[model samples]
Target: MYPILFSFGSIHFYSYGLMIAIGILVAYYLAEKKIKANGIDPKRLEWLVFSILAGGFAGSKILYWITRIPDIGTDPTIFTNLGDGWVVYGGIIGGLVAGWFYCQNHGMNFWKTFDMVIPEVALAQGFGRIGCFLAGCCYGVETHAWYAVVFPEESLAPAGISLFPSQLVMSAYDFGLYFFLEWFSKKKKFNGEVGAAYLIAYSFGRFVIEFFRGDMIRGVVNGLSTSQYIAIATFIAGIAIIVIGRKRFSQSNK
Candidate 1:
């Protein structure tokens, strides 16, 4: 794995940060195209995307800290060490919440906006996982499989051990999900259906992938990782959104 892509005389360019920036730009391009097609004011896209990113970052960091409460109690400096640790679920939730508020404030249709944005979120996540793989974070358990990867000494993962490539798997899944959701959005019966589908699909996929994860910073409870528990709740919420949305749509038509 290559954490530092390159170093200029006194400055180092990090692969993780680079990939994240790439993801954001790509996602924004796609989202802007979609919003313009859907009759949304393209001018609003910047502030909307900014709000979601800001909220997602805050939420991810806050959840990471929450999971490390015991460690934080032992050493409070962890709170100020902002460069490491993030939770994807927290980012998803926070981004959605922030997007909802933005939509409401701007008199935009929240569900329609959510449907348009979620696919790009998946696309961004796919790229982010690539960053995780390059940085050797969110690595998988040791394995002797043909596809196993070994990080370099400088990477975050343990060096000299062949481990399952969970990050790549997750990245592939996210990319696939992005394609599927993009297609599904066209055929969705209700405004929130696409977003709900994203929630359901991503939660199930994440829950399964968590078993392959080797990192312990994410926390474990009752034989399952914290993410798995959140996945269950997110799955349920997705189902509820679909059911309620359909019901409301039917009632309005009636």
Candidate 2:
């Protein structure tokens, strides 16, 4: 793993940040094309994307801090370590809230916009997980299985430990989800169906991936990680949304 892609004397180029930037760029390109094709206003989409990024970053950092609160109580200085650690669930929640508010204020269709955007989010996340792999964060538990990866001294994961390639697995899953959602979009019966499916798909994948994750930075509850609980809730919510959307669609037609 290579955290610092390169250093120019006093300056350092981090792999994590670089990959995240790349991901965003790629995702934006895809979204922009989609917006134009769908006849959506580009300016409003740009503003909505900005809101999502800002809110997501804040929420991710806040959740990371929340997870570390117990440890912070024992050693408050632990809070100083802020170069890494983010929760995707929190970011999703925050982005949704921010985007929803923006849509409401702008008189935009929230569900329609959400459906268009969520696939791009998944695409970006796939690249972001590659960043995680390169940075050695969100590593997997020790395993004698054939697909184990060994982190070097420079990596964030414990050096030389043979571990599962959880990051790559999650990355693959994200990409797969992106493609599946893209295809499913065309056949979806309701406006929010694609967005709801995204939640269900991502949450289920994440819940399973948590079992392979080695890092304990993400908090756990009753043997399940915080993400697993969120996954369960979101999965249920996804089903409910689909059902309600169908019901409403039928009522309107009737």
Candidate 3:
């Protein structure tokens, strides 16, 4: 489905890569605006973003490799083939860890920064899902629904079969979540509320979406996809954060 966006004299630009780049830029611009409005040091934005991105990339790749461990015995290229395979959950965790460390090192308030940035992360994910759709990755199960899509021969999805279009669905969910997070942030009683809400909402959404997913490359454990397990844990973690954060806020106020 038009994976190659354009070609320039023997060089081709892929739709997936292009869309991700656009997503990063858009997210970064929005984050800058948010940081400035919140009185954060605008200069710290560059390094903070860089650290999160680097950590996210590494985490995604590492998780992908872990899932492919079974394939490694059959295909030695599984570890070296860095062109594809990444776990979104891994990226989320990794980015947060990196951001936390960066904030600690730079004397920034981690929860405050995360609350401001998490909505942008969802926005970026919305664009990234568009990339996944264009590349025909993260495809949905075959369906006879009227809204099903059919990928061409060049696409990664099974060619010419009507499918559920899960990528677009996820994209829409991400976009909607971004707006909801933004609204929640405004009404939040504590610094970590928005970020915690994000984890809960996104994890639950992902857990449900996994049922629609056709690709099983991400591994399954005990009748559930790898992400489903992670989603459960993430959801619990989110709840824990909210409880702890609210308690801390209450204590501080008293």
> Whole-model Cα lDDT per candidate?
0.93, 0.91, 0.93
Tell me how far the alpha carbon of residue 53 in candidate 1 is from the true structure, in angstroms, after superposition.
Answer: 0.2
Give the Å error, residue 145, model 2: 1.4
Worst 10 residues of 1 by lDDT: 75-84
Q: For residues 1-254, write the lDDT of model 1, one tens digit per residue.
A: 99999999979888999889999999999999998998888889999999999989988988888888989878898788866688999899888889899999999999989999899999999999999999999999999999999999999999999999999999999999999999999899899999999999999999999999999777899889989999999999999999999999899999
Candidate scoring better on lDDT of 1 and 2 = 1
Residue 217 of candidate 1: its Cα lDDT? 77
lDDT of 2 by residue, 1-254 (tens): 99999999989999999989998999999999888999888998899999999999878878888888888888776567667878888899989999999999999999998999899999999999999999999999999888899999999998999999999999999999999999999998889999999999998999899999989777788899888898999999999999999999899988
Per-model TM values vs. the true structure? 0.97, 0.96, 0.97
Evaluate residue 222 in candidate 2 and report its C-alpha lDDT on the 0 to 100 scale. Answer: 89
- Pull out the clashing pairs in model 1: none
Which model, 2 or 3, shows the larger lDDT?
Answer: 3
Clashes of 1: 0
CA shift of 91, model 2, Å:
0.8
* Candidate 3, 85-147: lDDT as tens digits: 888998998999999999999999999999999999999999999999999999999999999
As a TM-score, model 3 comes out at 0.97
